[model samples]
Target chain A: MSEKQKKASAYWKENVRYLFILLAIWFAVSYGAGILFKDTLNEIKMGGFELGFWFAQQGSIYVFVILIFAYVRLMNSLDKKYGYDE
Target chain B: MDVQTWTYLLVGITFSIYIGIAIWSRAGSTNDFYVAGGGVSPLANGMATAADWMSAASFISMAGIISFAGYDGSVYLMGWTGGYVLLALLLAPYLRKFGKFTVPDFIGDRYYSKTARIVAVICALIVSFTYVAGQMRGVGVVFSRFLEVDINTGVIIGMVIVLFYAVLGGMKGITYTQVAQYCVLIFAFMVPAIFISIQMTGNPIPQLGMGSRLNDGSGIYLLDKLNGLSTELGFAEYTDGKKSTIDVFMITLALMVGTAGLPHVIVRFFTVKRVRDARKSAGLALLLIAILYTTAPAVSVFARTNMINTVSNKEYTAMPEWFKNWETTGLLAFDDKNGDGKIQYVADPSKNELTVDRDIMVLANPEIANLPAWVIALVAAGGLAAALSTAAGLLLVISASVSHDLIKKVFVPSISEKGELWAARGAATVAVVIAGYFGINPPGFVAAVVALAFGLAAASFFPAIVLGIFYKKMNKEGAIAGMVVGISLMLFYMLKFKFGIFDGGKEAVPGLEKDWWFGISPEGFGSVAMLVNFILSIAIMKFTPPPPENVQEIVEDIRIPSGAGEATGH
Candidate 1:
């Protein structure tokens, strides 16, 4: 295999690892914390917004939007880094 | 003018505008017929997609669903938008880089199998057509209520208007028309919501108005009051949890995955000129969608709180015109349960009226808040636009799948380009007639059937397409087997309950444990099936041989957007 292709493969491996970690965080906030731990997180409050309530209403959505943008930025950088970019 | 008359006028005008736009923006070329000439900018495509994705479900139904389901309805909110993230990250870019005319083409070429492509085309048709029928039904319902037309007339009128532009403009026309539809629908959604929020919470922003202190300043949240009323009415607590945690999780996962898999939504990605733009557009489209999604729960809370407060012990004589108007549409009917002159709308089991169609709650919300009639009419137009935009998108996919994927590619590869375009128009014309028929006489469980559309998409297509791109070793045999298993399992389960296994018309009710396996509801079980698809496909591919080295090079090329220039139906 060519050196550039090998480098591209290595880049994707690192990228997939990062994606999994970020996805795990995404899942925990929306599916895990906001949902499964709703009652538990209700104990904590944030300026008239309970932690769990905020997560259900706005926190998770905000986090998802941030995650998508972050993935775009990170992926673009990695793409350029490994010569896989357009 | 009275609110009703004004609403009628605005509704009429909006339809004309939509038809006018459809005519002016119609596609003129074969490429325009297919991918809007593949020149749509990321931002424009993003708006078009947001309009396409947020259907009558979002505009008319989502808030009402959230109002009643309370915290549990977050599944719809998260699942629908979250799928876009999955699409942008895992699917959209690669699919765009594949540079295909239709999804079946990708499956056909990547798997290197004719049977697999045919299977994909069938799945796409069923899901797209079934989903489009639901949209048409929604449009018919909206038109019948607003314009005082018969439901059949409403459905037929909608069919003609849609056929007028959908057949003429193709994807190019649909994209621009969808942009206009998005504006109308969003405006329609927000105006009344803003008014209601002000009346209920004295806040201007409906989204914040939901969490704000109520007018009473009782130091209690609005959700608490709604929850109290619901529990008092014999319904589950509005904010308190009701569904099992596992069912909620699975359902949310299914919806999110299903959203990503939907052919109509995925095809929007192809309209953009570059792969990178597809990624950007997905993010922007989500941003636009999040505006309504974030506000919907708030709108539901506002509407429900005011509704219960106003109607809890109110005399029927003093009820407003909004109540009477919706009654004519059969959206709001009150049966005097206790021989009392007053109508009690509490969540109580025996006493409260059981006649509210959730669709009315959002559309009727403006008048419920005593807002002006123009806002109500705007909502009427908005609801139709939402349903029509999605219906148009689905119709395009169905037509393209038949003409581009099945006919031009598979059955008649030697057909001329002009002949293929005519075939596409013909497919669209046929789809419109069928859609109208189903709209008028929808099969039982129309709502539930449409919900299954996402499941089919999730179970069958999502895994194969994503794996085909990301996993180098995933083979044709694995793709076909995974799709067959995923979709079959979901269909078997749905048919068991929906149509009754062998009994034709009768249904047998299963106990809680029997109804759900692994605590997953049918609406959300697609995610589980998808997981099965991914795991088994990988396992099978490990034992079987991978694609040849030349195929590996194609995979590598698809990873880079620039390499897509040479690909045609690739």
Candidate 2:
């Protein structure tokens, strides 16, 4: 395989890895804690909020923002590493 | 000043500002018309995307819905915001790198088939029109209530204003105007929230105030107090949900996926200059949106708690002026079903004497809280901004699909650039008129249809676009088949279950819940349909010829982050 093709594949591999990791957290926070395990998480309270309720209404949104920014940072570095940065 | 006078002043100023921006940013070419010349900065594009994404539904009705739905409302909060994460990660960067003028442009070019593009165009048109009809209704409601204009007059005024900016300035005008609208709506939303937060819990932040102790010195958390109040009134607990867990899971997934597939939101990414800008702008848009989305639940809690405390079993004659004012609008009505003079707001429909519309939670929040009249007026302006901004965005999507995708690419491939621009403006004008008609005389099914737009988008576009990018061998035949089958299944379910077209009609919909597929409501059935679309597309692709070598190469090119250029008509 050509060097360029190999580099593209590597960059894509890293990108997909990041996506899986980030999306897992996304699924965990919203589907797992917020829904599937909500009753379990509700047993624990943070201040006045049930842990499950907080995750669903507020915490997931915050985590989503952080995850996007983190992806941006990671992608920027990856692009630079692969010389894909414009 | 009175609320009426203050509303007039603020709405007048904001309308003038939008018109002025439109005149200044008039589209000079087709590029500008379609994508604001493809040179918008990340921040400006981010602000525009936020304004476009948060419609009248988000601004006006979401808090009220959440106030009533309690824990079940988390689907909206997580669903809407979580889609941005998907867009930022999977769709936006690649689509921007493809550097297209519209979603259909990507589908048409990547799939190498006109049939794929036509299907995409139809999907875009259906999704956009259904969504825009609701915004026009929202604008009219805000106007009739706050400005004392006839609903038809309000819709006409909305149409003229949107026509001026959308036809004249196109995406350029819409983008700048949306930035201003975002500021107006968010400020209008936050001020009352902050005030009520401090008033009720002695906490300045509404998010924290929702969890803090009540200012009544009862030493009870607000949620706990609300729970007690709710149970006393025979309602569910404030933090508990009535929806089954599986239904919540499906609904949240459907909304999140649908949000990512929305044409208006996805088009905002194309307006940015580079792939990186698309990624960054998507993140910024969500951050801007999260400011309001996170505040909505808090606002809901505050509004609900205040409403119950003030009105439940309270003497009708001693009610506040705002209560009387809202009652006059027919949104807050007291029937006095019992011979007693007190209001009974219980869970049982037969015994409940007070009928409060859910929309009143957000619209009458400031008045209920006794904030200044000007603050109440600001909310009217904000609601109008939210409605108008989203309507403009949807109208652009409709116009682009019709003129650019249908006329320019398919039928009039040889049409001049200037001619195409004229066609786009004409389409926008026609779309505005149709949307206005729907607004003035909303079909009985308008609200039901709006929710189905997301479901339809989820069923049709999400799988096609994702495969068009990620799966190199996904042929047009597979995509077309999948979209047709997927959307048909969704439409069938929605009609049978939501509109009840098959089983006699709307009256039968109540009993139809027991027959739901996997106990999923029509709203959440999109998840099931989308999964089918994915499985069918891949399965069909295995038996058919792969996409051409050039199309596969195009997919590879979009994967790289560099060298995204200005959007151009092919």
Candidate 3:
């Protein structure tokens, strides 16, 4: 394979890795903390909210917005690394 | 001015502004019509996307649903917003890099099959049309209540206004109008929320106020008080889970995938200039949406606590004006079953004499609190903005599918650009009329029917688009088979359980019952169907010849962000 092809493949691999890591964080927050472990987490409270309930209702959405921007930043730098950014 | 006069004025002013914007930004070319000439700024596109994504359901109905469902309602709060993450990371930037006018354009070119495109067009049409019906109904509901016109007339008025803007200005017109809509809607939503929050907890931010202690010297946390009131009235605890964990998991998953896969929402990314702009736009859209979403639960809590404190066990003869007014609309009904001359709104099926339809809480909030007439009027205009903005977006998708994908791409490849543009406008006209008809005479539970649109999109498009971008080896045969099987499974489940086909009609399908498969409701089954699609597509691709070299190259091109420019017409 050409050097350019190898570089492109490596860029794609890093992109997929970042995606999996970020999405895993997403799953952990929403489905894990919010639903499956909610009952246990309810034992703890945050400013009058059951911790799990807060995660489900408010925290998850806040984290999701942040995650997207983080991904955007990560990808922009990744694009620069691979000379893919304009 | 009186509330009625105020409503008319506000609604009239907003409608005129939308029409004025439409005339100012009329589309002159196919590119202008499809993706607003692909020149929309990220911030503006973000606002338009928020307006487009938050339909009548999000604006008018979600709080009401959250109010009643309590913990179960988090499905929507999480499911809807979570999709943007997937869209940003998995779909939006890649699709923008491809620079397509519509979703089926991607599917057709990526898979190198007109047949796959046709299948995608069918899915897009079904999803958009089903979704648009709900938006039209929302517009009708707002108009009839505020204008005191018959529902049919209200529907017709909405139809005419949407036709003017959607057909004339196309995506360009829709984008600017939606920016206006987002402002009107967020103002409409937030103003009342701030008022109620201040009233309830002396905290102006509803998000913080919902968790704060009540200001009535009760010294009790608002949620704790709400929970006590709910259980005392025989209702479940406010924060307790209602549906099984698996069902919640599945429903949230379905909604997330559905939100990511929706054609109208994905198409918004194409209107922006660069692939990086697409990522930023999705983030901006989520931030805008979060402003509403996070507020909805707070509003739900405030409405519920206020409703219970005001009305529960109160004498019927002295019921408040808002209660009596809503009762007249049949949305809030009361029956003195025990003849005690007192209303009992309990969780017990037989004892609860008051039946409160969930839709009224948001609409009646300002009146319930005795706020100024103008606030109520603003809400009426806000609901209209939410409904019209979404309907316009969905209608564009429907028209593009019919005119661009079906007519120009598949049937008449030699059609002139001018001819195709006319066809798109003609299709938009037909779509608006059909949506108006549905609004006038709704076929089924509009919101429930719209939920099926989400499930179908999740089952059909989400896997195809995600895989088509990520998995270069994915072929036409796999995509077609995946979409067909996925959509067919979802339709069959919805028809069998929701509509009661099959099973010899012996008993109702176990939608939320223990008899369900792992207690997964029909709404949640789409996640399973999506899983099936992913597995089926990968398995089929393993045996089939790989997608052609050119198709693979296109996939590679979309992955890289450099050299992405304006999307051109086919």
Candidate 4:
């Protein structure tokens, strides 16, 4: 196959990798700390907020926001390498 | 200045500023009107999006929800903000890269069916209008209280303010004004919070104050004290969560998916100049919004702690001036049910006033803490800003549906850019008038209705848009069938529960009124509906004809975003 097709295939693989990793984290934090592990997390403390409370209120959101920016950054670089970026 | 006069002057000045910004940033074309000409920087767009997304509901009701729910309230904070991650990661960049003006455009084109487009249009209208109705009601509430007018007059005035800019300015007008509104509402939210924070705990940040030691210098955690106090009065512990574990999880999921599905928020992503910019804006928007979401839990703790300490098991005569003042607005009431002069507020279902509206907690906080009048005024202005900015964004969605989706796409395929532009303005005016009517005579429960809006969006729009990009086999028939079934299920379920339609006797809807489906509230079933939508579309697609090759090309082009490859002739 030509170099272009090979690069496009690589791009597709990378997109799949990033999406799977991010989805895993999304499920883990929101579902994991929020409801699934509430009791276990309650044992911990962050200042006045309990360990579970922190995850419920701020931790999940902070992580989700970070993942989005990271994806964008990663995608932009991938786009350039694939001759897709503007 | 007298506190009353200063409040009048302050609110008036803020209104004028919003108007001025709206006129200055008037959209010049249909594209300009819908997506701000796609030149907005991620940072500004993010702030405006945050301001637009965080409505009166988030600003006013969230803390109250938390205060009562205690640890369980985390569902809201996590669920509400978690959707942004989904939006930014799974949706925003591709949609921005697709470079469409509206959500339906993507669904319609990718699905390769005008039927899909019409289905999307219906979903968008239902979602946006249902959501806008709540914001309009919130605007009326703020206006009636601070402006010293009746609810009817307040709704009329609120309508004019929203129409002034949304009709004339479009998304461009709403965007700039929202930037200003974000500032007003955030400052108002933080100042009082910080003061209360420092007063209660040595910590100045409300987030820190929450977990910090109480003012009595007791080494015990504040959460523990709150738990003890509330349980003593028969309310659920402030620390222990009481809702069914499955239900909380479902509600959180529904809220997250619903947030991701909102068209107005997604439309904001199209305003950015590049795909990467859309990503940056998501982060920045989350940061801006997190400032409030994180602090709100602290507000819940502080307000709950203070109210329990002051009003619970206490005499009415000892109550502060703010109590009587707020009572006039009907936001706070002391029924003294036992007629014992002292008012005892406890979570104990039997003894509590059982009447405290969640919205009142934030508004009454300033007075409860005895903060000065200006801060109170600022809170009023903030409430208005939160309501108005979000109302404008939702209104833009409503207008664009008529002009861009209906008139341009459905009615007149050959409509000129200028004609489409005028049509948008006309649609916006009509939307404003209609929203005003709902605001004046709000239908049923405002919060419940708003939840239905999210369910509709999640069930109908999210599936079509997501499938359009990833599933090349999803034809127009599948898309339309999916949306119709998904939204109808949501509508029927919500209406059945709300009106008791299913019950056989005078009060019907037997199982619905007795129990929510699967213990999930009507508002939260959206996530389930969306899942059903996805399943139905995929299942049916296996038996149906696939979309033509050209539609596959559109999906591939959206995925790659290399260039404006081709324009399929309408």
Pairs that collide in candidate 3 are none
What order do you get sorting by lDDT, best first? Answer: 2, 3, 1, 4
Off by over 4 Å in 3: B504-512
lDDT agreement of model 1 with the native: 0.83
Whose lDDT is higher: candidate 1's or candidate 3's?
3
lDDT of 4 by residue, B1-570 (tens): 655666788789899999999999988877678888778888899999999999998988889889878878887888779889878877887788788888888887787677888888888888888788888888777777777788888778888988889888888889999999999899989999999999888789887788888877787778888888887887777777788788778778888888888999999998888777887898899889989998898999999989888777777888787777777877677777778788877655567663677888898888788888898888888988999999999999888888988899989989998898898889989998888888888877656778667777888888887787667678877788889999999888777776565664333345653477778877678888889999998888888888898877667666665663212123
Q: Quote the lDDT for B49 in model 2.
A: 97
Q: lDDT tens string, model 3, B1-570?
A: 999999999998999999999999999999999999999999999999999999999998999999999999999999999999999999999999999899999999998998999999999998998899999988888877777888789899999999999999999999999999999999999999999999999999999998899999979999999999988988788898578899999999999999999999999999999899999999999999999999999999999998988888899989878887787678889999999999888988889898998888899998888899999999999999999999999999999999999999989999999999999999999999999988888986566769878899999999999999999899999999999999999988887777666866633555525555667888999999999999999999999999889989998888888888899765
- For candidate 3, the chain B TM-score comes to 0.98
lDDT of 2 by residue, A1-86 (tens): 89988998899999999999999998999999988999999999999999999999999999999999999999999999999998
Please say which candidate is ahead in lDDT: 2 or 4.
2
For model 4, what is the alpha-carbon lDDT of residue B271? 89
TM-score of each predicted structure versus truth = 0.96, 0.99, 0.99, 0.95
For model 4, fnat equals 0.78
* DockQ for each numbered candidate: 0.54, 0.91, 0.87, 0.70
Where does model 3 sit among the CAPRI classes?
high
Every candidate's lDDT? 0.83, 0.93, 0.93, 0.82
Q: Give the per-residue lDDT digits (tens) of candidate 1, residues B280-319.
A: 8998899888888888988888877777877777898898
Q: List, residue by residue over B1-570, the lDDT tens digit for candidate 2.
A: 788999999999999999999999999999999999999999999999999999999999999999999999999999999999988998999999999899999989988999999999999999999999999999998998998888889999999999999999999999999999999999999999999999999999999999999989798999999999999999988798899999999999999999999999999999999899899999999999999999999999999999999999889999999898778778888999987999999998999999888887999999888899999999999999999999999999999999999999999899999999999999999999999999988998888888878889999999999999888889998899899999999999988888888888764457889999999999999999999999999999999999889999999999999999898888
